[model samples]
Target: MRFNVWKRLELAAVTVGIAGVVLVGCAAPDEAGVSDARVAESFAAMYTQWLTEPDLTEMDRLVLDEAQRTGRVTQGQYQDAIDRLVSCMADAGYALQLTTYPSGVIEVQPPVAVPDGDDLMSSKHFCEKTTSIYAIMGYEMQQGNPELYADPAVVAFNCLEDADLLASTATVDDVKRFMYSSERDNFPFDSEDFGVKACFYGAGMAYGTVAEAE
Candidate 1:
């Protein structure tokens, strides 16, 4: 089965910072096509871009807070863990770039905020919202060629995870609201009426599915 190498690598890149799987906002697959090498290069580029941003502080704090809440680390260790995450990303990015993967053009928009009045840190909320969005992409791909890809529902669930970070450097509440609103409004697919197929078509990915594009 042709695996959507880009999507898989995208999942790896975003979740690499955390201990578990995590999802960031969605991005349209590259029109130029995808390959394992390209995916690695794209991931490296994305990771590098993410690291350069100052907004990552909120994500760092969120990770630390969760660690403390779970008793995984003492307060004094928070900074250390945060430092480790950065180092990890740096190392991972470098490693991915070292591969002989080909390059592709994949455009990802910043996440749109969707106001669901849900808790920002709620795993359920993040999963449900992201799953809904990913499901659409999966469905569209399947419609084009079922044998080409795996189940969209399964991929969406496995690939996407809750993110406790935000961009504005604002209060957690403000950041949460902004993220939620962005996801709701700016989703590349039209989620209105929850039409997964329609949204996929709208994304202009209907001609080909994102299933492993080997």
Candidate 2:
């Protein structure tokens, strides 16, 4: 296996910082074209890029299409999340970075972890959002190969929890709307619909956290 050795190493490395599995994003099979080393490199590069180039508009453009394609979020919901996230970041004086992992997962690190920032993510609400997103990702990948990863329904549950947190501030209805919209947009990819759902669930969870904080 190309990633057998590297996978072990990456897991160990990540475990040292053990923020715990907060979000469960989709992960590809071990046979996915991208090698394990490639996955680690990609994750690191993406993380760095997100930190250096923190633009809300760019994030919206890049993530919205993917979210829509996978039924992760509706365009309107995406916009709302974006607005809410940006506002939260501005208010908290923090930034966000989305790091893609080879396990077909994407991990998010708070802005406070950056060179100069304060950590305001200790709130219970923030933790719920983080874990929910990861579960959502897990769910998305599970639909395709449930045994290969963690439970997909966990993603849904976490996303739901995160949405509840945001309900006090923003309209939680939009979260469901975005997910349905994402499902409608990705109608063609039937077999991979589960994967899409997982992805969207992650998106919803992540966005919900921002909305709640805002």
Candidate 3:
């Protein structure tokens, strides 16, 4: 599972390194200030939300329980959950591939060459619930957002300001537009960009399993 949260997946649709097109960075000016406790509370609530998910399998409940007790999902726990998801999908006859890009993006390929719109998503969701994407997201969130930005969009806003990639007066909405609007190739969030590369270092992209994944 190449789900390195610091890389491009942080801004992706799932916000968990699942075929995302942007990266996470660090070094925010005072404006992005957010309390660590607030961030942790929001993140905890997010992790808790999954506990009530109807799609969760019995195994998912066990993972969530361990996470609750620990207050953090160890690298091993996160990877184990990913392994379970892959295995579960395979068991269901949907062969899945988790591909890690050199840019540290992780993509879970579709199970089949061509799939029915409804069936493919349904099957993927079923298998996905067996694993906890939150464990990985929590790691990245901790890294790229040590301040624990309760708002995911704000994380990138600070990164943008830190990098001076955009105008100094840019609003969070403007950054949001950059995130949802810009193409990865032309934007500074791309791995090839030096500014974000610096942010990667600040974000501490390496720790335990996350280091190995990258």
Candidate 4:
């Protein structure tokens, strides 16, 4: 019950934050010709892809092993729970979608110009928000449809959240910090470097969640 409530609240917060960011980002850019919608859209679209494609079998093994290690469940029941979850995702039609606000001109000026304004602050802010957003989405999706996920769905939820959030942000280092936080350190996954490879691979897998789980 605690996990259920926590998951729901986190999801609501994420959806609201993402919605607020979309509203704010729709304004005109500062000096750059880019649209805030562009950034927001890109982030949303990419993260959707990450949630859809995972080796549910392998992930099942990992979750059960960790649960065993953490004493949540035994090895024998892990596969059964995973099978139930995969079925749930398939049955639920769990597709990710992006909602948006309209366009408007905001401002064009140098940034707030903090001591380390150019890259560091920009990276951290975007990364932190992105991580929060996906964590929220992951919690929402799996929790809202608990019948669709395996036991210990939180484990997969965290994995998808970590990867999806990092992949959604603006830069590589920030993404790494978001993905490799202490909360996720024991999860046994690698940090994805940014660039076309990370973008396509990381984001590509998320979209694959729409397809039937293997």
Candidate 5:
């Protein structure tokens, strides 16, 4: 099947896992008609692109090549990536912890004392850059979002607009930028409504794990 590879967005940290992770806010080529194949194309392209980069470890290259060949990152592949990343982090002297969410997003929890910026990168970036980064993200795109809105925040903000919950003029980026900058706590939408939750679901983002919690 043909896929319209998405234009990768500069997604800021959605969960504070790693710096500059390629998830949560990746935009598609258009608002609709995008699909899992498209998402896979974007990810697979990255896999190929990384092959051109000299620094990628041979092990990582093997994993990426497999994903590209299959046009998707399977659960086994994603798990392997997580394992590789965790092992790499251990080698770097950081004992990072893994938190698994139902939607296939893994939270790599660095220690509380871990400093931000360069120090953080020095300790953890290689592992993340090489492994599982969006083996997690791309997998979720295929599983969770079929309608494929650019990102959950974009769709949800528009949903809110329909509900009169947001200013008529506010763009998705406008709202997201504000929330990230200041309101993080005081931000307007609660995401409790079923319809709003559906908006995020349709957008490929897990609303509170993207499943009915047991």
Candidate 6:
């Protein structure tokens, strides 16, 4: 399973050349010394907390209604989307523990120059991979259970969007600090590995290490 997951991730890196548009801003200079462990812990805690909070509120309903009326999704599809969203929230805890934290599986090499755009790209790809897994599960759910909702790509994109928004709250400086630590601990996967792009791809590959373990 781990091999397969990594294979898929490598394929994604090669084929999915979509430029990462999500920008997690930089941390303030004062926060530069923060540790990677702390950043990971903070993200895990906040993500778990966010999952516990109710998400399908009045605004969500209104958005669904609008999407239905506009024919973006049928009423049935809207309900299915809601169900998938709920399930994603519920699974956040296991996903964080299994795919994110163990052994610092999500590590990235630090940028020599501050405000490296690759850092944000790494985050975007990380979130996208998580959503892709959920999307696949959604597809399987539809085939096995008629009552379940699917539209895997749509759900995945929604998940990606939501994650992007959530990541914006993290202090960028702290994230960079963590990257530096990771670089210090695990640098130059090879002499050929060069620049932020290599580091970003490495981080992207690292994203699902925990999930593959499970």
Q: What would the TM-scores of all predictions be?
A: 0.18, 0.24, 0.52, 0.18, 0.52, 0.18
lDDT of each: 0.27, 0.33, 0.49, 0.29, 0.49, 0.29
RMSD of each: 20.1, 18.9, 9.5, 21.9, 10.2, 17.9
What tens digits encode model 5's per-residue C-alpha lDDT throughout 1-214?
A: 1111111222212312222223334444345422112222255554454445455556556666776776566877667777877788788777866556455645455554555546656656566566655555545444444333344455446556665766455566654543334332334544444544444443433323223322
* Residue-level lDDT tens digits of model 4 in 142-208: 3232221111222233334444633343343333333233342323233332221222222211111
Give the residue spans of candidate 6 off by over 4 A: 1-37, 40-46, 50-202, 205-214
* Clash count list over all predictions: 15, 21, 0, 11, 0, 3
In model 5, the runs with Cα more than 4 Å from the true position are 1-50, 115-118, 129-175, 185-188, 191-214
For candidate 3, what is the total of clashing residue pairs? 0
Question: Per-residue lDDT tens digits of candidate 1, residues 35-119?
Answer: 1121112232323333343444444444334433342223334334323433443433311111110111122211123243243
Encode model 6's per-residue lDDT on 83-163: one tens digit a residue: 443345344321111222221222222222336455434553444343333222222222221221112222222222333
Off by over 4 Å in 3: 1-56, 92-94, 100-107, 111-113, 131-146, 157-174, 182-214
Deviating ranges (above 4 Å) for candidate 1: 1-46, 58-117, 120-214
lDDT of 4 at 139: 25
Which one wins by TM-score: 2 or 3? 3
Model 5's TM-score against the true structure: 0.52
Q: What tens-digit string does per-residue lDDT give for candidate 2 at 1-214?
A: 0001101112212312333322233444244221112111222222322233223244444443454345343334433443454455555665545444333444344542344322444332353342232223222332322222233233333343443433343332343344333433222222223343334434322222222234
Error of 4 at 93 (Å): 2.5
For candidate 6, the 10 contiguous residues with the lowest summed lDDT are 144-153
Of 1 and 6, which scores higher on lDDT? 6
lDDT assessment of candidate 4? 0.29
Residue 210 in model 5: lDDT: 22
Q: Where does candidate 4 stray beyond 4 Å?
A: 1-72, 94-176, 179-190, 193-214
CA lDDT, candidate 6, residue 206? 27
Instruction: Estimate the lDDT of model 2.
Output: 0.33
The CA lDDT at 103 in model 2 is 30
